[model samples]
Target: MSWQQIQPFLVALAIGLLLGLERERSHTAGKLPAGSRSFALLSLLGAVAASVGQWTVVAGLVAVGALAAIAYLRTSEDDSGTTTEIAVLVAYLLGALAYTRPAAAAALAVVVAALLVSKTRIHRFAREIVSDIELADAIKFFVVALVILPLLPDRGLGPYGVLNPAKVWLLVVLLTGIGWIGYIGVRALGPERGLLVTGLAGGFVSATATTASMGRLSRTVASPRAPLAGALVANLATFMQLLIVIGLIDGDVLRRLWPPVVLGAILLVGTAAFVYRRAIRGPREDLTTEERPDIEPTTASRPFALRPALLLAAVLIVALLVGRWGTDVLGPNGAVLAAFAAGLADAHAGAIGAATLASQGGITVNTALTAIAAALGSNLLVKCVLAFTAGGRRFGLGFLAGMALPAVAFTLAMVMTMTMR
Candidate 1:
């Protein structure tokens, strides 16, 4: 027999064993009526019937459901949940799915087994850990990102082919999503570690938004020090990402760029370390305390700041239009200007553009380096302005101290490189 002929049955049997193992464990706990043997048979039964015809799978379902119903009726009152019966039905369907897509079926079976194992944690989190408002915000973010995002047109709209609704909405989603990420991190690791972790992760997504989210969060916390550290840590991702982009697109540009980028990154690390040290010494609300305060503690206290994200997106939309219109007709020199325009809001945007153009031989390496510097400089200024605007003086001052000195070093390095020629 061909491999294709035997693959589905073999895969179905494996999936059955995996699902059955979880059920068998539950059965030992007296919470489930089905065991490893029953689940394995059900999966094999599905595979055998589905092999016969599509309609045979339906017949298999009826027979399985009938058996599951009988099992349910016999289950004790204390353990009277449809979980086992539902699993039985799902195991059979997974077997049927394996007839065509064995890989997808196997992957889903693992997820199902994991869910079974995580019952206690999931119950506790849903019942106790997550607040009504936090859950609601999570649902809203999902609806926007998953449901609404895909529905918008992908092409650029409005003036200068700059306003792509989907892309713009994605930025808005990103802003809100960064906040959620930080919130979850804080919940998992406590305030100081959480913000630091999420800031590093969020920077890869959108450093500016991460900075804004952290800055805005600084207002709620007793000390801005931790959030300030998070905001500064996010810049580390900016440098690393630029290096990756430049290296991939143009090696010469990467060589030209790495010095200032490295210098700036080293400075950022020292600044973040200093801020984090201060955060540890400062007064902070115990985020994971058992005693519930009237208000939530530290970072979780505020709802994901949606209004600011929307306003930032609005500002970015204008930047995109102005950037596009100003540089669209400029050619090579125009690309550099475009990079500056893009960099005003996004550190990587213009730098990537310039590097890509130089790689294509549209401009020289030195020109690409210049454009990149312009972009980075413009973006640094934006981050500074946003730090004050979103986070207040303490946050802003922390941001400036972390960012400004490194920026000066970067410019001096660039200028020194020039005069040497």
Candidate 2:
């Protein structure tokens, strides 16, 4: 027989052996009906029977099920589960599948074995790690991302053709997903690691929101140092995300943008590290303690807020309109202004629009870079304002130190690159 014809039977046997090994390993804990040899034989039976006819495979499956039932009855344990029996039936089917689709059969077997092995970790995560509210929020996030997002129209709509429902919903998903990561990190790691973890993670989702949240926290805490450190670090996400956004819009733009952006992020991180050291070493009495009056951490209550995500969407929509209008009215100059304005709301929107324009040959690469840089500057300024308004002077000043040096470094990098070109 050819390799193809003989390969299926061999695969079927392998699948059975793999599953049987897992079942046998698990058998130490309980009275499992099937073990390595029994499962291997069951798979071999399915492959041989299916090779004869489809009906033979079905009959074999039924027979295995009947034998499993008899085994369960003989054991007569009230608490006995049917997992092994179900697995036996699945293994038999996989053996049959191996004849026609050996690759699929092997893949499914691996997946099943993986699921079996991961049982403990899965249970531990579900039972102990994830909170009930987090689970509910995850369900909601899925609904929005999968159910609602797919249903939205993909094309741009509205008077100026600025609104694309799919894209808008996509932003919602992206923002919420980013925020959720930070929320989970902060929740899982606890405040012991404090602002550094929270800020870095939260920055990915919404640096502005992180700034506001951290700022608010700063006002309530005795020291304001931790929140100040976190707020500064959160701005790093802004530049990091800029790289991602521009790369999505135009690779050329990203290629040109990365040098300055990366330099800025490194400077910001260095500044944040300094502030963090100072904050951690600052007077204990000046910091939040169990006895101190502190604002309840937002990460504990919700993974990501629906209201903020929707508001962000609203801001992006406005930026889109203004950006399109700017391009139409003032040509390239208007585009830069639009980017600056949009950057104040969200740097990503401005960068994306500018990059799109550059990609379309409507603007020069230099012009596109300028627009993106303008947006970044505006966004940073907004963060600074938020630090002052929400976190007060101490937090604002601390954040200023973190942000200013980076801004200077980035500006110098941009100038050096431009001059070199």
Candidate 3:
């Protein structure tokens, strides 16, 4: 081979050497089987052999494979088999010789080595926490966030005038991350504290869903106070959801609304705390032994399906179109109606649609605020209905009261502000 061609091979050999040396040091420290010098020699030899030609590369692979097989055969007969070390050694030689595809081979080598080193920890983690569903969901989430979101077009379309796939998916990511954190917290609390923590966390995850769950729990259990406290906590999640929306759509709006949102959150939290304390103090008998529902990080059963996302995008387009049409026909009231109608299934979509309209000068801040408020109102109403339908009369009444009071207060506050302004 020419000297020019040999340069790339030399570089590949150097990388292999460095990695093998690290592995060798680990082996010496009781974490591996071979030393740095042995690995380095193997790597250098592999690179030289590969550089020679196809026949030389084949010969090198066969030699390494034979050595690995012998090592494994010898060790397997012993109680302390070291076949893994042998396999790693073979891999190291192969990686070094992979000059034509050095990057891919090196990456594979690193991953294999990492997997081997993390064997104990990985086993422990599997035993302690990971479930099949969680694993599947994690993989699905990865596909959505990494694979799909990036490929979508980041531009607007249709009449009412705003669509950005990147931004929308980004919002989805933000919500999923927040929901996942809350789900973890709830799961960690377990069934004993599940009701309270789940309710609070659920609010962050999905307040409406939490309310429905708690309402059902209340009906069979007869713990009015538990449902009451849970309901309050769930509403607190609504406030949080609004804050999240503001943060996602427009930070400036959040900054302006901070005072009211903070005040509202503090009141709701304090009320929930007081109710929780009272309920706990009253009776241990009231608490039942139902297993805590495993709250998913994301509400969607299927993790961010493209079909659903596309459907939502379509809905946003319709909302924008209707909102624009409403503004022209019924004025600001039409836009508010449009937002409320859209918010029925997705507050995030509604908020985004309204914000986009406002930004484009097609709607005023008051109009946007009204639309947001209406959407939230509709969303809360849906949850109330879900609680009643899914949970029963006892659960429904308690949940409705819990949700309604705060919602009413919020509505009044918004109305007064708009009027005063």
For all predictions, the C-alpha RMSD in Å is 6.0, 4.4, 8.4
Tell me the tens digit of each residue's lDDT in model 2 across 365-420: 88788888888889989988988898888788878877888899998898777566
TM-score of 2: 0.77
lDDT of 3 at 345: 79
TM-score of 1: 0.70
Off by over 4 Å in 3: 1-126, 285-314, 419-421
Query: What lDDT does the true structure give each of the candidates?
Result: 0.74, 0.78, 0.65
> Mind giving the per-residue lDDT tens digits that candidate 3 earns over 1-421?
7976676466556555655665654443233444555565666667777667778867877777677666556555442556455644655455454666766666766766676567667776666655566567667667777988889788865554466667667666666656656665565454566356767776666676666666655655536676667767877766776687676676545555555566667767776777677677766634434533332222224322345445556667667788889999999988888889988876766766777677778888777877878877787778878877866777677666655556666667777656654
As for candidate 3, its clashing pairs are: 27-32
Ranked candidates, highest TM-score first: 2, 1, 3
Q: What is the lDDT of candidate 3?
A: 0.65
Error of 3 at 366 (Å): 1.4
Tens digit per residue, CA lDDT, model 1, 35-135: 88788888888888988999999988998999999888888565777887899999999998998899999999999999988888888777766778878
Best by lDDT: 2
Could you tell which candidate, 1 or 3, scores higher by lDDT?
1
The 10 consecutive residues of candidate 1 with the worst lDDT sum are 286-295
With candidate 2 superimposed using the best TM-score fit, by how many Å does residue 73's alpha carbon deviate from the native? 5.9
The weakest ten consecutive residues by lDDT in model 3 span 295-304
